[model samples]
Target: MLVLPAVVAALSIIFAVLTVGINFNLIHSIFIRKSLNKSKSLTLFYLRFVIDGFLGLQNAIMSTFILLKFLEVEYDEPVEFLFWISWTSMNCFNVRGILVIVISLDRTLAVFMPISYHNFRRRIRNFYLAIIPLSWPIVNNIVLWGVCQFRVNIPPGCVIFTCQMNQCYISYALSFEVVSHAIIALTSLILAVKLFIWNHCTQKGPKSRDLERANYLALIDTLIIIIFDIVPAGFTVKFPALSAQFGSLILVCKMSGYALESWLVRRALKRTNDIVSVSYANNSSMIKSTGQASSNHRHHRHINNHAWQ
Candidate 1:
């Protein structure tokens, strides 16, 4: 029964590791290229990459523990510490869910107010604000963990093996998941609608091309999130049995979102490189033309002087 989840989790871990390497390269590419170094939006992408990496690592570890305990491969006695570790990891999804919200909100803001967005992007301090949402999942899960540990008195052996929780805790967990799903869906819908309207509007004179590209990327991200995270979460809440089945698949979806972000970054970098190449070519041609014109003028002046002499 658990074999699929185990294999999926193992694969998720490998994919996550590869994602981390890819994200590192993406960030490095931005810094190494002088043109990309000035881009504040690209700098902000580092947050998403790090959060995605953390989520992947956390999910992988959580799945490993679940597999080990289920097969009785080791840890016959469930250590209190290990149980808490698993519990903490389980909450990472929620944190990632909130981070998705943060990304959506920031992208939306950039679209709505490109001028102000540029001003905001200039400050390093403002970029740190995205990290604030991390607390939401962290605090929520800690309280839930407390409820299980103190209020419910979960048996030590069943801590890992059982999904049986007090109705209150289960209700809270499901409600939280539902709420997060709703938020992600609603925000994505809003952005998609706005983008559609903007596309139709004849006058888009004020909007910067970069903002347009960013919003388009956000729209794609929202679609991906809806497919992977939101839908799976909704299904899990409605059908508890599927949670066990789709456990590692959810982790894969999370990693997929990160994969998308890395792809967007690389695409943006390529576009920038193309623009720089074209600009450099234009400048080289202009300089050569200017030099030829100056030489022609000097030659003409010499000819006139020699004729007069």
Candidate 2:
């Protein structure tokens, strides 16, 4: 009993912090400093990053409340808000995953239809605009949950062997979660394979080497994320429904995944810096050589002209 509440509380905190660090602390405040930035800035990234940022903030706020409840930090839950937040958080997360799925789809399209992808690339703003309406159904469900305060009656007060963590409800949520995850995993896997084949068969240039490295990085990232998120989230509340100490194992896993993603992103960015530096060095040397050649040519021309005169 003590452990379950604490575990829930801790996950609430972890995810809440993830929401803040990823969105407000980094993307919104530090990154989104441009007025009309579109798809270029890490903030925009074809509008994908910014949208994730927005969703992150919402997730963070919702997570904070859940953590607060677990702490028994009473804010007078009308039962309605609990229902709203519970469903909203889950749904919004799903929507966020969809955004990532779209990014995967975009990458696939880039590979399969390079010319057509470029044509639509400029209108990423439209892509973001389109995702907004798609979230309404999720939002509506949350609102309805709140309005109804539909709390599951599980031995009243505190949950025991009795649980609001009901099987049927869990099944419904898992069915949806697994299906979405499966779709994402399937699509990304196929794309990765196809990408590998193309990379193998195609040119072996410098750009291609960087691409191959990025592919390996991306593959690692996809697998890590898929493992963490393939939820029967009730699983969080059910199986290892162990104490926070026990959940520590899973917590470490989550942190490792986050760290890995961070490392991969930095590695990806580092390659860009290295390329830029090398390009600059090459350009500098070229300019210097050209200047020396010009000076020598001019000097020779003057001497020859003097001699001729």
Best-performing candidate as measured by lDDT = 1
Q: 1-309, model 1: which lDDT tens digit per residue? A: 467766666666666666666766665656664445344554445566665656556555655665565455655554565556555655655666676677778777766775798687566464466666656765766666675453445565553413435665667766776787778778878787777777787545665556655566567666777777777766665887867764456666666666666677667657866886887899999999999999999999999999999
Query: In model 1, which regions exceed 4 Å deviation?
Result: 1-3, 32-38, 67-72, 75-92, 113-125, 145-170, 204-209, 242-247, 284-288, 291-309
Pairs with steric clashes in candidate 1: none
TM-score of each candidate structure, all chains considered together? 0.74, 0.65
Q: How accurate is candidate 1 locally (lDDT)?
A: 0.64
| RMSD, every candidate, angstroms | 4.3, 5.8
Candidate 2 local lDDT, 1-309, one digit each (tens)? 345655654664565456345534334433465322122323223243344345445444544554555556756544444444445545555564565565555556666776787588756764474465356456445543454344555342332211334454455555665676676687779878888777688836555434344345445546766866553243555666443334333333443444445445545555655676688899999999999999999999999999999
Give residue 88's lDDT in candidate 2 (0 to 100): 50
| Candidate 2 minimal-lDDT segment of 10 residues | 35-44
